[model samples]
Target: MGGLHADHAKPDDRPTGLPTSSATLTPLVVKMLRHGRIAAEHDLLDIGTGAGGLTAIAATRLGSDRVTSVDIDGYLVDAARDRLAGMGLSPHFVTQDATDALPGDYDRIVATVSARPVPVSWLQALRRGGRLVTTIADTALILTAWKTPDGGATGVIERDWAGFMTTRHGSAYPPGLDELFETAREADGENVKLFRYPVTDIRNNWEVWSMLTISIPGIEVDFEETPEGRTAWLAHPDGSWARAEATKFEPPTVHQSGPRRLWSELESIRNWREVEGGLPLYGCRAVVTPDGAIHLSRGRWSATIG
Candidate 1:
């Protein structure tokens, strides 16, 4: 599925209880198909059947009998079923949590939504030598792996970046970090330092953003251009917060509070990239063990996600 924000004309009017802002775009569906390397004979599992667009396409490619689509929301499932039915197609549509046990073993599993440390059930359901295409939650890292004989999967991070809404357990997602955000807004941080670099918006920098998400999960960031300069705020669930301001070629003035120095961590990653030329997030080797741990290795550095 696409991102969680709706594509309504009114910015304040977003659909509730929906899996994503919109159905997976056609180009992205094509990309997933290309990366999945699906075959006409392969039985495919389409996780997160948001609007049935991907399911329809798969059904059209492979027979409808060979396609199974699932989602957590009954409403979405029914809607997707109806949409497909209208087009004279009836792919299997199941209403179940993507993280939960799936129905049948398949040769290909493609998830439009993102998952953290991909669910173990996916590996179990995937037929040996089958491929699974998905993105990691909160990051633009797209992973496509082939199931191995040792009950593990090995793959490389694709150089292309794409993000989808994180998987949800219910009709709607839980509330965001409102209380934590409010606290981070005014708390007197533990330390402050001058950032000897130009203010940079991390969101626009996909490589750094992806690396940071993997290294430090649950960090929320916001940036805007102000009369004072380029201003940015970084907040963490653990009460860490930082405010930075800079203009043109001048260094940034930073104010930080809370236990962790969030800005320092960001700067450290940036410094590493400055020295290394690029982050290891892309083109890295990913190994998913039977226990649901995702290990990423590139050069001499490695990290594990459980």
Candidate 2:
């Protein structure tokens, strides 16, 4: 929360040698804390302790002894320890992979970073009836569920759209899909068609971007406004790719290749929004099994992420 500005460092300015930690915005942190339903008597775990901001707030509200913080980055853990110590507050700090065994049972567990599958260890560490608040990776879907008697958890996705950096297990994330991107740049796509809709920058539209992520996981997107108009590219690790270009209020030219029609899929989602007036991602019911599979359902539509 405190280091929100620093966490948003420009991509070009970030050092290539160090893994970056994510800091949550103050407002979002408050929302997560409220959804967690933390109480003064409850024990808490602050996962992904980037800069110790959330840990500090919890310690101040719940006392230092009742809070435990863990992170994979030893460097970040050490820095957070020192920062908390400066305020005359010291909470238990453990430097380890969060997906591994955690230290203590807690009534509340809040993660500031996004996880692919609400980690299984988190469910094991939470007491029955305890709450876990977190977001899914690659999308702005916030989940807050309470552990049930049978080891599964049930809850709903928050209406707000909040995003954080994904968790990592090493010094840095694995290299990007350079080989796939390079091939997609020049490879002749199998299908070329005229796109009837005006070129839209999906990245700038949170709803469309989030829906696209759910519809096509692991897809990468890029956009640029050039003198010719707007150009956009979509690439997937499976060799699927699409390139589109168009000016304001004009239809774009689209070319796609690989096993999937990436642009057409996007257009389908856009058309669905046009018909339904919105997406079914937010405020949906979320159920998590003990094995760490998460399922979200709203009306007749449902999706699973693990």
Candidate 3:
């Protein structure tokens, strides 16, 4: 279950699969494509052409002319194009950042990669009432929205969850939270206390990870098993870091420091979830403002995906 779950690493926060980024799992690909409600007449723009599996399937089902796949890496786009050509499929392929100006009007846009906020550019390129299926960066919430006439979008957080590497503007991603993690690896920290809730394995706990990610964006997670016990580290770009150490059948000792108490924040989210019965991400209705700010609301609970 933990295979591709991630926050910042959304796989990139902790990469897997291909050397560059995690390709959408085949099952998830099929699920998304099906849910995408693709029609033979729909012009589809597939983002993050990793391994080209999704592109191949879409091109096959929708026909190559109806599909346009893009990736930031030219090499990936070129390679995927070649592979598809062998199968007598040639969808339009482009090598550029997905967040940039997307070319062509698309009736359906499905990104295997994640986006922080639904990019405005995407909305601009989408035809009216077009369908878009993508995941929120740093979480596993699959978003399916429709282009609204107001230049925004509205939809829902699908009942299922999936994670893809966050979209990158360049071949290499910007720096990560390495400095804070280095200190967390050893420093005792400015605040040390006992965790009220069980230590969280952000890597594996998809719901909690999604909640925390939505609550506090840019949190990166790392954990390791040692002969002594288990250690989990959470670092944020804002210089906040938390380290928890625990052994089997025992409580964790938490050490945290910085502008925010990362561990306490996680505990708070867990506690809130306990009181609320569960998170509001799944099955929640989402509205992407004309500016691309995604707002979600379900019942009386609400949260925005940044």
lDDT of each: 0.84, 0.84, 0.85
Give, for candidate 3, the lowest lDDT window spanning 10 residues: 1-10
TM-scores for candidates 1 onward, in order: 0.90, 0.90, 0.91
Sort every candidate by TM-score, greatest first: 3, 2, 1
Model 3 lDDT per residue over 175-197, tens place = 67777789999998899988866
Q: Which stretches of candidate 1 lie over 4 Å from their true place?
A: 1-21, 226-228
Segments in model 3 whose C-alpha atoms lie over 4 Å from true places: 1-19
> Arrange candidates by lDDT, highest first: which order?
3, 2, 1
Q: Candidate 2: which stretches are off by over 4 Å?
A: 1-14, 17-19
- Top of the candidates by lDDT: 3
Residue 280 error for model 1, in Å?
A: 1.1
Candidate 1 clash total?
Answer: 2
lDDT by residue for model 2 (1-306), tens: 122234445756535432356667887788888888998899999998988899999999999999999998787888899999999889999999888989989999999888978888999999999999998887777889999987879999899877787777775677766676666666666898888677787876777888898878898887778777987788888878888878865888888988999999999888888899999988999999998899989999999887
Question: Per-residue CA lDDT of candidate 1, range 66-157, in tens?
Answer: 99999887777888898899998989999998888899999999999999889988999999999999999878889999999988799989
